[model samples]
Target: MPRPRTVLLTGAAGGLGTLMRGLLPAYGYELRLLDVLPIPDEPAAITADLADKDALRAAVHGVDAVLHLAGISLEASFDKILRANIEGTYNLYEAARAEGVRRIVFASSNHAVGFTPRPMGTDPLIPVATPHRPDTFYGLSKAFGEDLAQFYWDKHGLETVSVRIGSCFAEPTSVRMLSVWMSPDDGARLFDAALTAERVGHTVVYGSSANTRLWWDLASARALGYEPRDDSEPYAEKLLAEQGELDPERPEHACLGGHFTTDPPIWPH
Candidate 1:
């Protein structure tokens, strides 16, 4: 049997973080959870601000590898993204280097390329290797993470993989989701590929499902041995019936689900 690796997972209290926390144990990993809030059930969790160098160092100590999911998640002010996403990610990479951790799996998002046109509902899903066309501050923050991954892999000996997650949800909720939905089971597959793949240095891959209707080519993901079984296309008819059609010309509908292209932006007023 393979030895259990110590996996330090940040943001264990958040949605995706929580999902990964429960799943890591099943994958033969000794899990260490981290978040600003207290971990549920008081499992082995570190509560601290990721931007605090000393705190991050403490969290990284003795962990063989890291799954960095901690960061501001949505379209927020530049200040929030800078502190939580940018600085916090930097702190993790530095801490990982100091602790001699071997690898890191970063949680990037589809928003990183939100400016690119999402082909119409009739078109195939875009592939994982698309060029980044960020649409919001949050998207830019994820882009920074990708760049940081490259720098760390080049300067230090650390191996890094950036998973640009699409819409991760319990189920497809809207018309746009037909192209973006990523189920938890599929997410686990994506992360598993990142964790155990061979010779992946600072590579960026989309986190999506194996839907036949998906637009993106998953050849890069397949190279890492990721085999997603779920498909978002099944929910297409139902979601479209409920939400009605969005103007394909609208930025939100036209490109990358209008996440960055939406008018007025979905931010606090």
Candidate 2:
């Protein structure tokens, strides 16, 4: 198989974005990093807002595929989510379509399926291929992106994969993370599968690891040849003891993972 040559990556300044920028280059993809903030060290970084059609169009120029990571990520006011996540996503899709870009690997979030409940005893509870049950505005935006991917694939023939990413920290920090954390290596592999998978017209897969305590299954992503390495169970004992009490809510305790289903909003402004 021919290697993915040139990829246009957005949101390079963010955590996962930075990791992807570092890893993608090593995987033989000539990276064109994009973000509103300047990343001087990135070889081909472009400073632009994805919501701007003209800027997004310019960013999409001459790229074979787009690993779209740009967007607002918090469960804030509806207006904020609309402009950054919704509109920005639309601009990227339309721009990719116009540029004749064949593939799009979108950075959808676990929050897209956040509302799904998982019982405490079951580790492999929330299967990755399950239907979306978005919990917040941020998650709703991701749901929209997934639908948009379907629209683009059905109407414009653009191959797209919406990866509902879990916690992508350096290490599993809390009890819930034992079920939801996505190691950097696993995250990169997921992106690779999304980029190079054959006949993936439109698909949704969970972005997570092969953890023994994981709440999600990777059958969908397995078809794309993704084999994740890391497991969060190694830190399970330490995390659960440290995190104090687990929430009483079934949605909070169940496989869906995290406070995405909680009453009080937890996103930073």
Best by lDDT: 2
Using Cα atoms with residue i matched to residue i, what is each candidate's TM-score against the true structure?
0.92, 0.92
RMSD of 1: 2.3
**Tens digits of lDDT, candidate 1, 1-269:** 12329888898888899888767677788888899999769656789988789988988899878899988777788998899999999999999999998889999988888887876656666776677778888899998999999999999978888988887788878777777678988888888888888888888888889865565667778888899999987788887788887687655777884646675254433
Q: Tens digit of lDDT per residue, candidate 2, span 1-269? A: 24468899999898889888777777778888899789867656789887678988988889889999888766778888898899989999999999998999999988888877664563345666678788888899999999999999999999898898888878988877776789998898889888988889998888889877666767888889999999988898877787764675555664363566665264454
Positional deviation of residue 114's Cα in model 2 after best superposition, in angstroms: 1.1
**What's each prediction's clash count?**
9, 2
Quote the positional error of residue 166 for candidate 2 in Å: 0.5
Q: Candidate 1, 99: how far from true, in Å?
A: 1.1
- The TM-score of predicted model 1 comes to 0.92
lDDT of each: 0.82, 0.83
Q: Which ten residues in a row have the lowest lDDT in candidate 1?
A: 260-269
Lowest summed lDDT window (length 10), candidate 2? 248-257
